[model samples]
Target: MKPAKNSPRARIVRYTVFGAISLAVAVITAFGYLRYEQRVDAMHPALTGIALQMRHDPAAWTRQERDASEMLRDIREEKVAAIGVSRDAILVSTQTGAKYFVTDHNGAFSNALLLGEMKAGADAPYQLVWLPDANLQTGMARWAAAFDKIRDLITLLMPLMLIGGLFWFMRREMTGGAQLLEESPTLRFEDVIGAGEAKAALADVQSYLTDPARFTDMGVRAPCGILMTGGPGVGKTRLAQALAGECGASFISITGSYFSAKYYGVGIQKVKHLFELARKNSPTVIFIDEADGLGKRTDTGGGPAEAESNRIVNQLLAEMDGFASNQGVIVVAATNHPENLDEALRRPGRFDRTVQVRLPDLEDRAEILRFYAAKLTSKADDIDFGQLARLTTGLSPATLAMIVNQAGLVARKAGASTITAAHFIEAIKIARIGDVSGAERALSEEERTRIAVHEAGHGLVAALLGTGVLEEITILPRGGALGVALVTKAQDKHLYRETEMRNEIQVLLGGRNAELLVFSEASSGAAQDLQEASRIGLDMVSKFGFNVDGNLFSLAALPAQYAGLQLKNAIEHANVLLRELDDACQALLRANEPVLRAIAERLLESETVSGETVEQLIREHAAASSPSMHLAQEPAAA
Candidate 1:
């Protein structure tokens, strides 16, 4: 029995055989034509020499030249047997078995002499005849003849070429289904450090891919797509890889940007082909990174690029919903910009499952740190992973890995065998403030003193106010700032209390206050501090409902044109609020002036101070203010 012509296997076999045959024919035809053309070209110079010789001295010519001249003089008058044609000459053989060369160029005589010696090795004598342009016209006509033959060959194969291309494209589109199917996963779900919830969600997906029958029995359809959303470096793409790895399915990874084109239909064709491949390879995981670029909302005002994007998006939607049964082709797409993706793409049928791959929290960061730390070898001591995690409160898993890798490099550069607490600390500072060591920002004694005073004020106020934990204070210049008071929350907080927010405002003003107290004026160094304070203050009044009225409204939701009025009102309210806070801040600073001066002195001496040292100093000052007293025994003696 013969197989059906339209069957997939039959198509593959037919096209494979057809392509092989077509390739062989093309090679043969091209080879024959090229050989003929080469032979014609090769004989032109020899023929030109012989033709010139015949023209200059017909009496000196051999029997071949005399006979050839008659034939060559009027090439169309009689049928002259010729080997080939040239642009301006022809090579012909006489009835007497002699060879003759002909040309119209006057310089052919000199060239003919050279060709005679070169071709003399063949032991064939030839004559040169210089014919007029009129006689040479017939020789030039052979180029058109050659072109005609080439055109005919091309005409013969053009249809076949087109058919072959269509067949190859379709085959690729069909077989593209599962470019790879892994019997086992190279990366398991456990390998991904964070995204526990996302990992759990994908576990069910793996079950569907591995055993769809179990779900099918329950009348549940497998989700066609899972959209992983998060900020950049949040491990969204890595989770996609882990999903494929866990499921042991074929992985076809492509970027969303791959399906965008300047030309129309190209992108749509690509999208169709991709889905066709996935359908053929039923148990396949298609991972698209940066999917927002491929599936952006269509533009109402259409252009070529816009039209192409819409076509691709439409094709993607069709493909996702095309299969009647759960084909086990789970598309895992990752995009940092979920809001930019088309609404249809995020709807029920397409990317039905959305997993938020957020920044790793404290516990997640600790585990992630340990995972990366284990990859390092020269560790003299066990790192305080808890302390490292606390320092990097909002850092991504990727950033944590970087810190660990950078710490190893730092330790190696210092000729240390193991990564120590100090190495990690330096790495954190480097990650936060950048490498100031390379900048060579040497400050004068007076300038260093002012920077010390400014940073000391920030650290002292933050410690006193209990707004945040003062990590470190440095007078060294880093990241365009003359100094920095590194303060961080002990843990990540999604919501800030009113007192905490107020204290933050005070802390921001500390640097400016310190400068005012010491120099009786402030410098441009407080620009960032003032800007941050203003933003927090304004947000308190406008967005957070921290004003007198205690009302919350979404200022961000307002139109841009109307925002100016709302923003002005917010700024007015904030100013009134800050005025009141300013008095409290001034009074607090005045009472803690001694502590501020003490911290500043220490900073000037050491150029840096730890958080614990600042806390200890504040505690000592507090204790001294209410010194312990002993009973007066003198009264009893009297």
Candidate 2:
């Protein structure tokens, strides 16, 4: 396995290697200069005398020298002492007084010593030596001469080294576009929390992958692609990983959005490259998270981004159903919006199977809670899984895991050794709504009482209507709401009848209804309630056609020409229906005024009340009105 270059250990090693190279280069260069200086010092005396003459008269040295520059170039690398002009011939001498002829003297003498001149200078030598300035012939100049060959060697090697390095980098990038995780995936199906149907479907796929020969013998080809559709935080990506792990295959994961680009053909090239990587690593799982982005419906309208997206989609389709079959490669894609995906990508030869990873139900929630809680070192048995499951009705498996983590944090904050039920309750509240204890304390007593009355109203109405199981009623300010009555459905409901819809609207307006019944006026606390109630009313009339006397006209499908008028008439009819529901809510609250009063009183005393306490109060109120109910029942029997 290659260590990431950005990892601390890798970075430290890289820096150490670079430093060592630099230090070695510096040492070698220093040693070369020192050796050159030692050689120059051996000819110091002769060089000193020549330098004095050159400084006094430079004209005599270079004036008769027609090839002075060439002579300097040729001798810079050589150790020479002096040079002189003897009539038309130039003479050179080393430090030992040995003479050498320079220039063309009688046709055949260049840097050649003259034996007769040595004897002539033995008695009384009369020689005028011409020399250049010592400034141009020592220290740096000497070192340059000593290291000239080494410098040439380095210069010659540099281009070859650069070319080799470039080739290696390009090769690494081209072949390593996606990491080939040689190790089998560690995630297993048991590691996943919910989505039982998705898990079962993926288990079958894993069987096909793990036993390819068995499938082939049965004349069955494995599905080329699988598309997991779900909302965010529903573990679509995790399911894909679990599939790979179950089959013990190499998992190459990438995001679909990564293939999109502003350039024309870059998207297409990247898509092809990704598939090629998968093929190279056979029996690979190519998991694309957020696949809808790359495989979106390709429309006829043209733009740079749209055209690029279309090209990426086309490339992906071709790779899935191309000429060669990808027998060993399985493409698993995840998307939150499967409806936005291209139809061609979902065809039989491509992603034939679409699995829905829906939100966890009560039992799933409890299982998810236990799964996460068991991973901790704290005491998990003290926490009631049944209550938690009922409380967290609509939470996804991801959110449930977070709740368990937050529970641990709460316990640690209070210096507890084990997470208890109180910690879980507090964590659940904090997860659903923000921690608002400080904000609650900021409110005056009058404001607190008003919030208590508001939340109590919602709780009473919800209990009366049997809309859902009431979890908790609290006066604490949370997430910009003055108060909240948390209700979770007893079970998941796919469709709603007209009675349930109307009851839900009534419960929403109950807070305002309570304020009017008790204080003879409503407060700004009911603003959110009114907004929610209005949205439901609009949806009921426009989207579902619950109003308009069973005409069954879908407002969403209305013609543009008459849409405005139709919508106005529908809303007007819905408003009349809302007025009737509001009256019904107020009448119901009045008939059960004693129940509402008792719950509001208990809330004001405690600032919060449990669901069980509310239920007990409702039973007591019903018992107190039994006589009137018996009298009404007698009239019905007669």
Candidate 3:
């Protein structure tokens, strides 16, 4: 039996690529020609400048005398064929095989070595012919006579030549030219992770695409469209393409941006062209990435430009709702902001199936990290995949991939065969923020002591709390801070209890508390730390109503009731909130000082402490006379 045949859309893509390549080659050739012409023009100026200088010279003869002399010279005629100019300022007639040079007396000199000589014409001898006073004037006159014809020839041919090449390139670009069907793309189902719930939701879509006849038999219309909505970077585009590839359907991918045109009818024309192309290639999936850009909601009061956008969108709606859409054509569109899309486009018959792509859960995150990790060099075999995944609490798959690549580079540089767990830990930190460009600083002995003590206070408290809240405390600078203590939970949770919120506030204030005890005044280095801690602590007391004092009652209700009103209220609330935040923040840092002081005194003696060291100290210290592992993640500004 023969193998399955190749798909049509694949053929279109292959041809399109070929056309683009041909166009690229033609453009390169044109550029080369232009450059050559420029160089020739650059050199022409020297000869032209010389001629201009000669014509404008004070010693030049009158026009009538020059013209009469030039006519007389021409009327004298050659022996047979016209003589051409040659090197040594001589003229050679090929027919007569004779050479003549212009003598000082304005007469032809035969066999005159002193004057100049030209060999019988074997080359373009006209190039070197000299011009006497009369000949020079006549030679310059010929240029004006010939300019019209030469320029017309160039003008007529150049654009036609360009168009011909562009047409040929487009033709080639739209053809397949024997593209292998097997290599269309695999898009294995598993490459898509975390959206398993989404995948599960969309399972029926495959049945609809593959067996539309089943619905036809039941006298029902199949879904001709599916919408994938998700946050940015959640792989909505990837899912659509993968599905098309997996189903072996013809995939014609174009951006929604491509459909929005400034010209009145152009957008509608493109839409018509796209759907026509889709209909011609049945079982085709038109994947428009970010379709909201094209099919935005129609506002009656919108301007002319928005009207143009709406027109294209209406055309798209017609194509989808019309009989053509149900005839083996499926349109899959992805957008982060689905709410912004025009309602007509996403109506029941149009974008009938909505698939929501979301961030992968923890297990999914682990799988994604593991897949990327496999490509990295000698990553430790038992490097705690679960633990690493847990540490990357809110990280996305894309971010995870970047982390693995960065750590692999670090491993490569260290001459280490395997990427150690430590390497990934560092990569995670680097990825979370940016590079630790200012990590190493010339710290005074006093500054180091203060920093060591401050960080220790945060690390010690979390260690003591056993909240799984503080993950790691590294003295190494990362991000804007010179040092940091990161907190994460093993499992991802959307909601935080009041206690969890307070614990976070405590961690933020830990450094400030330690600072006040170590130095008489709190360092401004804890500015961000204080700000963050104060806001949360204040919000808890005032807004969230989670505090003991009824000072929280002084706060107003939440803002976002009406659209414009919300923004105005939010601004006003921000001012009052700032004051509450400042008071609560100061009070928290001040109240926590006694406990923080003891922790800092211990940390001041210690140079660097990891999670392990913090835990050890937590075990060793018991409240006032007790040891604490809690440290504020606040590091000195880099």
CA lDDT, every prediction?
0.75, 0.77, 0.63
Checking candidate 2 for backbone clashes, the offending pairs are none
| lDDT of model number 1 | 0.75
What are the candidates' C-alpha RMSDs? Answer: 13.6, 16.8, 18.8
Native RMSD of candidate 1 (Å):
13.6
Query: What is the C-alpha lDDT profile of model 1 across 438-464, one tens digit per residue?
Result: 332467787878888889988988888
Models ranked on lDDT? 2, 1, 3
- Please give, for residues 1-638, the per-residue lDDT of candidate 3 as tens digits: 53335677767777899999999999999999999989966754434322343333412322222222332254245332222222222232223333232222233342343224446764432222233333432343457447877999989999999999977754443331212223334674577877886777666666666777787899877777888887777777677767766667667777778776545676777777777776776667778888777757556847888788777777888888876345878888988888878877777878887888777778988888888888766545867778788878777777888888998887887788888888887788788755676545766767766776678666655555555756656555566776676766868887878777766666666676666655766777788876776566556655665655434443446454544344443334444544453455456545555544444555445433456655554544434332223333234332
**Clash number by candidate, in order:** 15, 0, 28
Q: Is candidate 2 or candidate 3 better by lDDT?
A: 2
For 510-609, candidate 2 gives per-residue lDDT tens digits of: 9999989988899998988888898898888878878757757777896888788787777787787789899999999999888888888888888789
In angstroms, give how far residue 610 of model 3 lies from its true place. Answer: 1.4
Superposed model 1: Cα runs more than 4 Å off:
1-184, 437-442, 557-561, 628-638
